[model samples]
Target chain A: MLTIENLHAQVEGKQILNGIDLDVKAGEVHAIMGPNGSGKSTLSSVIAGHQDYEVTKGNMLFQGEDLAKLSPEERAHKGIFLSFQYPVEIPGVSVTNFIKTSINASRKAKGMEDMTANLMLKKIREKSSLLEIDSRFLSRSLNEGFSGGEKKRNEIFQMAMLEPKLSILDETDSGLDIDALKIVANGVNKLRSNDNAIIVITHYQRLLEYIVPDFVHVIFDGKTVKSGTKDLAIELEEKGYDWIKEMV
Target chain B: MEFKEKLLDSHLAFEERIDLSDAIHQTRLESLKTFEQKGFPSRKDEAWKYTSLNAMVLKDYALFPQTETTIQLKKVKKYFLYEIDTYKVVFIDGVYSPFLSDTTHDGLDVCLMSAALSKAKYRSLIDTYFNKIINKEDSLTALNTAYAQEGAYVYIPKSVVAEKPIEIIHFSTGKEKALWLQPRNLIVVDQNAQVQILERHQSLKEHVVVTNSVTEIYAHQDAFVDYYKIQNDLSTASLIDNTYISQEKKSNVRVHTFSLGGKLTRNNLNFCLNGQHCHSTLKGVTLLEDQQHVDHYTLVDHASPKCESHQDYKGVFSEGSKGVFNGKIHVDQLAQKTNAFQQNNNILLDDKATVNTKPQLEIFADDVKCSHGCTVGQMDEDALFYMRSRGIPKKEAKALMTYAFANNVLESVELPILKKRINKLIAKKLGVNLGFDL
Candidate 1:
C-alpha cells in the first residue's frame, strides 16, 4: 500500500531522515520504534508531505502516486491521514462542524456531492459512539481546552470518519493513561481492514501490546537497522535501546 | 468655497429655519463658535493621526439638500430589521420621512428630535439631557451640535420597560450631487427603566454623503440601556458618529458598534459613570476591505466608586483597507475600587491591510484594577495548516478562522435577528460560506 525508498529528508538545511527505506502491504500493521531524535516523527511528517521538510534524496509512493507532487490537502483528499502528536486548538469551531467541513472538502476535491445533513449526523453519531464520545463533547470547540485523552480519542474519531487508505498514528499513546490507551488502541484495531494500512510511530513499546503489529522496525541514526516480528519489541523493552545503538 | 468656510457661512441660513428665541439656541450659537474656532481636525491631532479626512473634506457637499425627496418603503425595507416588530424613526436626506417612520408615544416616547426640540411639552427634557454629556471642546461634536436638528428622541418613564426596540435609521437618497447630514438623537431612561436602540446610517446609491451624528443617552439609577450602531454604507458614503452616554447609580449600559462598509467612518463613543456600581460595556467589530477606513475612539470615565467597565474591539482588514482603535479609560481619584478592562485585537488579511491600535488608560486612583491589551497580527499559519490538512482550502480556512475570531464579540447581542443579520454580514464580508451558523 505504501513504499519509501532511501528517503533522505531535511528541514532548514539540517538532515533528519538519512537513507531510510520501508515497504508495507495491505491489511498489515507496522510499528516504527526508535529512541529520542531517531527521526521517527520526521518519517511520518515526510510521508504526510509537510512543506517544511525537504525530500533531498528519495520519494514516497502511495498507491503508485508520488506524494511529493501533491499539496497537503491534496494528499489528504487522496486518503493520507496523519494524526498529529499535538493537535491545534481552533477556538470557536465545534468538532462536529469541523469534521463536516473536512469531509465535504475532501468529497469536493474528489468531485463528489456533499453528504446530506441527516446522513452526516447519522455517521457522526455512529462513529462517535464507537469512540465513546458524548454529543456534548462533539459540540465543543475542536481541541480547545480538551484533555489529552479527549484529544487522542478525537484524533481516532477523525480517522474513523475519514476512513483513510493509510493511517499514521504519530505518538498517539504519549499522553494517554492505561484505560484511555486501551480505548484508543481498540479504536485503531476496529478500523483495520484488508483495503487499508496502519503505521504506528512510537518511542516506547507500551502501545505495541495493545495494537499488536505484524512487523516492528527499529530505526537508529535515521536508518532502519532491525526488522522483526512482535517478539523483538518485548526483547528490546526488556534489554533497552543501548545495545541496538551499539550494534548500529 | 472650502468645506470649512462654507460650513461657517451656512450657519445663518441654517438658523433662519429653526427657532432662535428658544434657550437652547444659545448653546447652538456657542457650539457654532467653537466649531468655527477649531475647524476640522487635522492629522497633527493625536486622535486623528491614523485616519485622514483630507480627501473627504475637500469635496463640496451641499450642507442641506436643495429639495425634499421621498422614498418608497418597499425599496428600503431591507435596511430595517423588518423580520421583527420595531419602532422605526427613519430619515431621507436629513429630513424625517413620516411615511417610513413608525414613531410612537404609547407610555414611552419614540418620536422625533425636531418635535422634542420645538415642542413646549418636551422643552424640559431637551434642557435636561440635550448636549449634557457631549464634550464641547471637540470640533466634530461641536460641528454636529451646530447643525443638530432631526434624529430620534426616545424617553422611557421611571420603571417602564420598552416593549420593542427602537430603530433609528438615516437613509440618504442620491438626489443631490453631494450632501452633508448632521443628526442628533436624545435618549433618557428614567430610574429603573430599560430600553434598547439600534441606529444605522445608509446611503441608497453611490453619492457623496457624510453624516456627522451625535447621540446623548442618560441612564438613571437602576436603569438599563442597550445601543447598537450599524455602519454599512456605500463606498461614497462617510460617517462621523459621536455618542455620549451618562450612567447614574447602579445603571447598566452597553453599546455595540458594527462597522462593515463605507469610504471612511469614525466613531467617538464616550461613557461617564456618575454614581456608584455602574456597569458599562463598549464593544465593536470592524470589517473593512478595499480602500475603506474605520476608526473607533472610545472613552469610559470612572467618576464614582466601585464601577466596572469593559471595552473589546476587534477588526479585520483586507486589501488596502485601514483601521484604527483608540480606547481610553479614565479612573478619577475619587473613584476607588474601580475595575476597568480594555482589549483591542486586529487581524490583517493581507500585507497591504493596516491597523493602528492604542489603548490609553489614565488612572488617578490607588485602589483600582485596570489592565489593557492590544494585539495586531495575521491569522495563525499553524491553525490554517490544521484546517487545510482537514481538506479545507486555504481561503476557506482563513475565512473560518477570521469568523471565529470575530464571533466572540457577538455573544453579547441580545437581539436574535440582529445577531443573525450581523453574522450574515460578517460571513458575506469575509467572502465565504461557513459550514455552520456562526
Candidate 2:
C-alpha cells in the first residue's frame, strides 16, 4: 500500500535522505531502525510533506498516487499520518477543538457530513480510554505544558482517532519509559487492520519487541542496508548500528 | 484655493463660528484658541513623528455641518448588551439622543454632558477633570477639546454598586463631504462603589467622517470600575480617542480597548495610580487590514506606594496594514513594592504588513518589580505546519494560529458576552471563522 522509490530529499540545502527505497503492504508492520542522523526522521517528515524538506530526486507513491505533489493537508486527507517525533504545543487551542477541526476537515474532504459536538465528545472519550490517556486532556491546550510521555500518548491517541491507512511512527519510543512505550505500542497494535499498514521508526529494538514488526529494515546513512524479520532489530540493538555502517 | 490655504481658511472659519454660552463652552473656546495659537502640529513635533497629519491639513477636506438625518434607533438595538440590565445612553453625530436612552435606575444617574455641565452638583467635578489628564499644550488634543460638543455623563453614588453595566453607543451618520464629531464622556465612580461601562463607536454612513473623542474616568477610594471601548467604523472614517483613568486609594480599575475598524485610528490611554494599594489593568487589541492604521499609546503611572499595574496589548495586521503600540509605565520612588508589567505583541501576516511596538518602563523605586517586552513577528511556522499536517488547509491554519496569538489578550476580558462579541468581531476582521471553539 506504500512505496518509496530511491527517494532523495534535502533540508535547507543539505541532503538528508539519499536514495531511500522502501515498500510496505497492508496488514504488516515495518520498523525502520537507525541511529541518530541516519535520516530516519527525515524520511517520515519528507513523506508527510514537510515544507522545509525538498525532494531533489525520486518519487513516493501512496495508494498509487504521487505523494510529492500533494500538500500536507491533502496527504492527511489521503489517509497518511505521521506520528511526530516532537509534537508541537499549540496554545489557546484545546485538544478537543483541534481534534474536532481536523476530523471535520478530513471528513469534509471525503464528502462526509460534519460530526456533531456530542458525537465528537463521545468518540474522543472512547479513543482516550483505549489509548490510556486522561479525558481531562481534552479540555487543556494541545500539548501545552504536557509531560513528554503525555505528548507521546497524545500522538498515539490522535493516530487512533484518525485511523489512517498508513501510519508512520517516527521515533515514538524516544523520551518514553518502558511502561509508556508498552502502552503506546499496544495502542498502535490494537488499531492495526488487514487494510492498514504501519511504519514504526525507532532507534532501539525496545519498542519493536512490543509492536512486533513483520519486516525490520536497518537504515544506515539514509539507505536501508539490511531487511529481515523482527530478529534483525534485536541483533542491531545488541551489536549497535556501527556493524551495519561497516557493512554498508 | 490651495489645499493648505483651504485648511487654514477652515480653521479660521471654525474659530469665528463659535457660539459659546455656558462655562463649558467658554472653556472649550479657550482650548480652541490655544490650538489656533499652536496651529496644526507638524512632523517636527516629537509625538507626531511617525504619524503625519499632513494629509488632514493639506487635503483641505470639507467639514461636515450639523446633521439632522435622524438615525433609526432600531438599527443599533441589536449591538447593545441585552444580558446586562443597565442604563443605556445613545448619541448620534456627537449629539445626545434622549429619545433613544432609558434612565430609570435609582442609584445610577446618566444624562447628556451638556445637561450635566449645567447642573450645580456635577459642574465642579466636570470642570476639574474634563481636560486635566490630556495635555492642553498638545495641538490635536487641544483641537478635540475645542470642538467637543455632545457626550455622556455617568455618576454612581458612594457605597452603591451598580447592578448592571452602562452601555453608551456613539453613532455618526451623514452624507456630507466631511464630518468631524467630538464625543466627550466623564464617568465618576464614588468611593467603595462598583460599575462597568462599555463605549461603542460606530458609523452609519460612508462619508469621510472624523470622530475625535475623549473619555475621562475617576474611580474613587476602594471603588472598582471596568471600562471597555469598541470602535468599529467604516473605511472612510477616522477616529482619535483619548481615555484618561485616575484611581484613588485602594481602587481597582480595568480598561479594555478593542479597535476593529476605521481608515486611520489612534488611541491614547493614560492611567494614574494615585492611591496606595491601588490596582489597574490596561489591555488593548487592534485588528487591522487593507491599509488601515491603528495606533495605541498607553501610559501607566504608579504614583503611590504598593500599587500594581499590568498592561498587555496585541495586534494583528494583514493586507498591507500597519499597527503601532507604545506602552510606558512609570513607578515613582514613593511607590515601593510596586509591581508593574507591560507586554506588546504583534503579528504581521503579509510581507507588506508592518507592526511597530515600543514598550518603555521608567522606574524610580529601587524596590519595585518592573518588566517590559515587545515582539513583532509573523505567525508561528511550526504551529502552522502542525495544523496543516492535520488536514487543515493553509488559510485555515494561518487563521487558527493568528486567532490563538490574539486569544491571550481576549482571554483577559472578564465579561463573557463582551468577550464573545469581540472574538466574533476579530474573526470577521481576519476574514475567517474558527467557530466558538477557540
Candidate 3:
C-alpha cells in the first residue's frame, strides 16, 4: 500500500531524513523505533506531506500515485492520516464539528454527498465511546486546555472518523496512560483490515507491547540500520540503542 | 457652494423653523459657533492622520432633504430582530415615520427626540442629560450638535426595567441626488434601571448620503445599559457617529459596534466613570472589502476609584480596504485600584489592505492595573496547515480561521437571535459556507 526509496528530506536548510527506504504491503503493521533526534517523527511528517519538509532526493508513492506533487489536503483525500505529536489547539471550533467537517470535506472531495446529521451523530457517539471518551468532551473547543491523555484520545477519535487507508501514529503513546494506550491501540486494531496499512513510530518499545507490529525497524542517523521481527523490540528495550549505534 | 458652506448656509433656514426661546436653542447657537471656528478636521490633526476626509469634504450634498420618503414595513422588516418583541423608532430621509414606528409611553419613554425636546413633561430630562457628556473640543461632534433636532429618545424611570428591547433605525431613500443627515439621541437610565438598545443606519439605494450622528447615554446608580450599533450600508453612504456614555456608582454599561460594509465609517465612542465601582465594556467587529474604510477611536476615562474597563476590537480587511483603531485609557489620580485593558487585533487578507492600530495608556493613579496591546498580520500559517491537513481545502480553511479569529466577541452577546444574525453576516462576508458553525 505504501513505498519509499532513499527518501531524503530536509526542513528550512537543515537535514532531517536521509537515505531512508521502506515498503509496506496491505494488512500489515510496521513499527519504526529510534532514540531522540533519530528522525523517527520526521519520517511521519515527510509522509504526511508537510510543506516545510522538502524532499531533496528520492520519491514516495502511495498505491502507485506519486505523493511529491500532491498537497497535504490532497494526500489526505487519498486516504492518508498522520496523527501529530503535538496537536494544535484551535479555539471556538468544537471537536464534533471539527470531525464532522473533516469527514464531509473528504466526502465532498470524492464527489459524494454529505452524511445526514443523524448518521453523523451516531458515528460520533460510537467512535467517541470506542476511545472511552465522555460525550460531553466532544462539544468543547478542539484540544483547547485539554490534558495530554484527552488530546491523544481525541486524535485517535478523528482517525476513527476519517477511516484512512494508511495511518501514521507518531509518538502517540508518549502522553497516554496505560489504560488510554490500550484503548487507542484497541481502536486502531479494530480499524485494521485486508486493504489498509498502519505505521507506528515511537521512541520506546513500550507501545509495541500493546499494538504488536508484524515488523520492526530501527532507524539511526536518518537510515534504517536493521530490520527484524518483534523480538528485536524486546532486546532493544532492555539493552538500549547502544548496540544499534555500534552496529551502524 | 462647497458642502461645508452649504451646511453653514442651511442652518439659518433651520433656525427660523424652531422655537428659539427654548434652552436647547442656546446650546445650538454655541455649538454652531464652535463648528464655525474649527470647521472640518484636516489630515494634519493627530487623530485624523491615518483617516483622510479630503475627498469626502470636496463632494457636494444637500444639507436638507426635499421630500419625506416613507418606506413600507415589508421592505425593511428583515433588518429588524423579528424573533423578539421590540419598541421601534423608525426614521426615513431624516424624518420620523409614524406609520412604521411602535413607541411606548407607559412608565417609559421610547419615542422621538423632537418630542422630548419640546414637550413640557420631558423638560427636566432634556435639561439634565442632553448634550452633557460629549467632548466640547470635537469638531464633528460640534457639527452634529449644531444641527441636532431628530433621533431616538429613550428614558427608563427609576428602578424600572424596560419590558422590551428598543430599536433605533434610520433608513434613507435616494430621493435627493446627494443628501446629508444629522440626528441626535439622548438616553437616561435612572437609579437601578435597565435597558437594551440596538441602533442601525441603512440606505435603500446606491446614492451619495452622509449622516453625522450623536448619541448621549447616562446610567445612574446601579443601572445597566447595553447598546449595540450596526453600521452596514451601501458603498455610496458614509457615517460619522459620536457616542458619549456616563456611568455613576455601581453602574454597568456595554457598547458594541459592528461595521460590515460602508464607503467610510468613523466611530468616536467615549466612556466616563464618574462614580466608584463602575464597569464599562467596549467591543467591536469590523469586516471590510473593496475600498472600504472604517476607523474606531475609543477612550475610557476612569475618574473614580475601583472602576474597571475592557476594550476589544477585531477587524478583517480584504482587497484594498483600510482599518484604523486608536484606543486610549486614562486613570485619574484619585482613581486607585482601577483595572483597564485594551486589545486590538486585525488580519489583512490582501497585500493592498492596510491597518493602523495605536494603543495609548495614561496612568496617574498610584495603584492601577493597565495593559494594552495590538497585532496586525495575516492568518496563522501553522493553524492553516493543521486545518488543511484535516481534509479541508485552503480556501475553506482560511475562512474558518478568520471566522474563529473574530467569533469570540459574539459569544458575549446577550441576545441569541442577534448573535445568530451577526454570525450569518460574518459567514457571508467570508464567502464560505462551512459544514458547521465555527
Candidate 4:
C-alpha cells in the first residue's frame, strides 16, 4: 500500500529524518518503535505532506504515485491520514461540522457529489458509537477543552470517519489510559481490512500488546536500525532503548 | 467651496426651511455654532490621530439633493432583511421615502423623526430624548444635530414590547453629483419596555455619498434594547455614525456594528450606565480590503453601583486597508462592584494592511473589576496547515478560520435572520465557497 526508500527529510534546515526506508502491504500493520526525538513524528508528517518538513532526498510512493508533488489535502484525497500527536483546539467549529467539511472537501476533490446529510449523520453515529464517543461530544468545538484521552479517541474517531487507505497513528497511545488504549486499538482493529494498511508509531511496547504489529522496526537518530517480528517489541520493552542506542 | 465651509455656509439656508420659533431650532442653532467653531477634526487631535478627514473635507458636495428621485422596490429589495417581517423606516438621498417605508404607531411608535419633531403631539418626547445623551463636545455629532431633520423615531412606552423589529435604512440614489447627508434618530424605551433596531446605510451607485448620522437611545429602568448597524456601502460611500445610549436601573442595551465595505467609515458608540445593575454590551466586526478604512471608537461609562459592560471588536484587513479600534471603559468613584471588560483583536492579511488598536480605561472605583486586551496578528499558520491537512483547501481553510474568528460575535445576535445575513456577508467578503453554511 505504501513504500518509502531512504526518505531523508528536515525541518527549518535541521535534519530530522536522515534516511527512513519502510514498506507495508495491504492488511499489514508496521510498528515504528523509537525513543524521544527519533523522527517518528517527522516521518508521519512528511507522509502527510506537512509543509514544514522538506524532503532532502529519496522518495515516497503511495499506490505507485510520488507523494512529493501532492499537497496535504491532495495527499489526503489520495487516502493518507495522519493522527496528530497534539490536535489543534479550534474553538468555534464543532466536531460534526469539521468532519462534514473534511468529508465533502475530499469528495469534491475526487469529483464526487457531497455525501447526503442523512448518510453523513448515519456514518457519524456509527463511527462515534464504535469509539464510545457521546453524541454531545460531537457537537462541541473541535478538541477544545478536551481531556487527553478524549483527544486521542476523537483522532481515532476521525480515522474511522475518513476510512483512509493508509493510516499513520503517531504516538496515539502516549496520552491514553488502559481503557482508552483498548478502545482506540479495538477501533483500529475493526477498521483494518485487506485493502488498507496501518503504521503504528510509538515509544513503548505496551501498545503492541493491544494491536500487535506484523513487523516491528527500531528507529534511532533518524533511520531504522533493526527490523524483526513483534517479539522485538517485547525484547525492547524488557531491555529498554539503551541497548538499541549502543547498537547504533 | 470646501465641504466644511459649505456646511458652515449652508446653515442659514437650512434654518430658513424649518420653523424658527420651535425649541429644537434653538438647539440646532447652538450646535451649528459649535460645528462652525470646531469645523472638521484635524489629524493633530489626539482622538483623530490615525484617521484624517482632509481628503473627504476637500471634496465639493451638495448639502441637499438637487431633485427628488424615486426608486423601485425591485431595485433595492435585496438590501432589506426580506427573510422576516420588520417595520421599515427608509430614506432615499436623505429624504424620507414613504412608499418604501412600513411604519406603525399602533401599540408602539415606529415612525419618522421629522413627524416627531414637527407634530405637537410628540413635542414632549422630542424635548426629552432628542439630544439628551449625545455629547455636545463632539464636533461630528454636533454637526449631525445641526442638520437633524430626518431619520427614524421609535418609542416603546412603559411595559410594552415592540411587536416587530425596526429597520432604519438610508439609501443614496446618486441623484446629486456628490452628496452629504446628516440623519438623526431618537429611540426612547420606557421602563420595562423592549425594542430591537437595525440600521444600514447604502449607496445604489458609484457616486460620492457621505452620511453623518446620529442616534440617541434612552433605556429606562428594566428596559431592553438591541441596536445593529450594518455599514456595507459602495466604494464611493463614506459614513460617520454617532450613537449614544443611556441606561437606567436593571436595563440592558447592546450595540453590534458590522463594517464590511466602504471607502471610509467611523463609528462613535457611547454607553452610559445611569443606574445600578445596568448592562451594556458593545461589539463590532470589520472586514476590509483594497483601500477601505474603518474605525470603531467605543466608550462605556459605569456611573452607578453594580453595573457591567463588555466591549469586543474584531477586524480583518487585507491589502492597503486600514482598521482602528479604540475602546474606553470608565468607572466612576461611586460605581462600586462594577465590572468592565474590553477586548479588541485584529488580523492583517497582508504586510501592507494596517491596524491600530487602543484600550483606554479610567477607573476611579477601588472595588471595580476591569480588564482590557488588544492583539494584532496574522492567521495561525499551524491551524491553517491542520485544516489543509484535513482535505480543506488553503483558501477554504483560511476562510473557515476567519469565519470562526468572527463567529463568536455573531453567536450573541438576538435576531436569527440578521445573524444569517451577516454570516453570508462575511463569507462573501472572504470570497470562498464553503461546503456548509457559516
Give the best candidate by DockQ.
4
Q: In model 4 chain A, which range of ten residues has the least summed lDDT? A: A84-93
For model 3, the superposed segments whose C-alpha errors exceed 4 Å read none
- Candidate 3 has a DockQ of 0.70
lDDT of candidate 4?
Answer: 0.91
Against the true structure, candidate 3 reaches a TM-score of 0.96
B366-423, model 2: which lDDT tens digit per residue?
9988888898888888788788788988887887777777777778777788888887
- Per-model TM-score, in order, reads 0.96, 0.95, 0.96, 0.99
Worst 10 residues of 2 chain B by lDDT: B2-11
Note the residue pairs that clash in candidate 3.
none
In candidate 4 chain B, what residue range of length 10 has the lowest lDDT sum? B429-438
Query: Superposing every Cα of model 4 onto the true structure, what RMSD results?
Result: 1.0
Please tell me what DockQ candidate 2 reaches: 0.74
In candidate 2, list every pair of residues with a backbone clash.
Answer: none
Against the native complex, each candidate's DockQ, computed on alpha carbons, is 0.73, 0.74, 0.70, 0.75
True contacts kept of each: 0.68, 0.66, 0.63, 0.64
TM-score of candidate 4 against the unseen true structure: 0.99
Rank by DockQ, highest first. Answer: 4, 2, 1, 3
Where's the lowest-lDDT run of ten residues in candidate 1 chain B?
B429-438
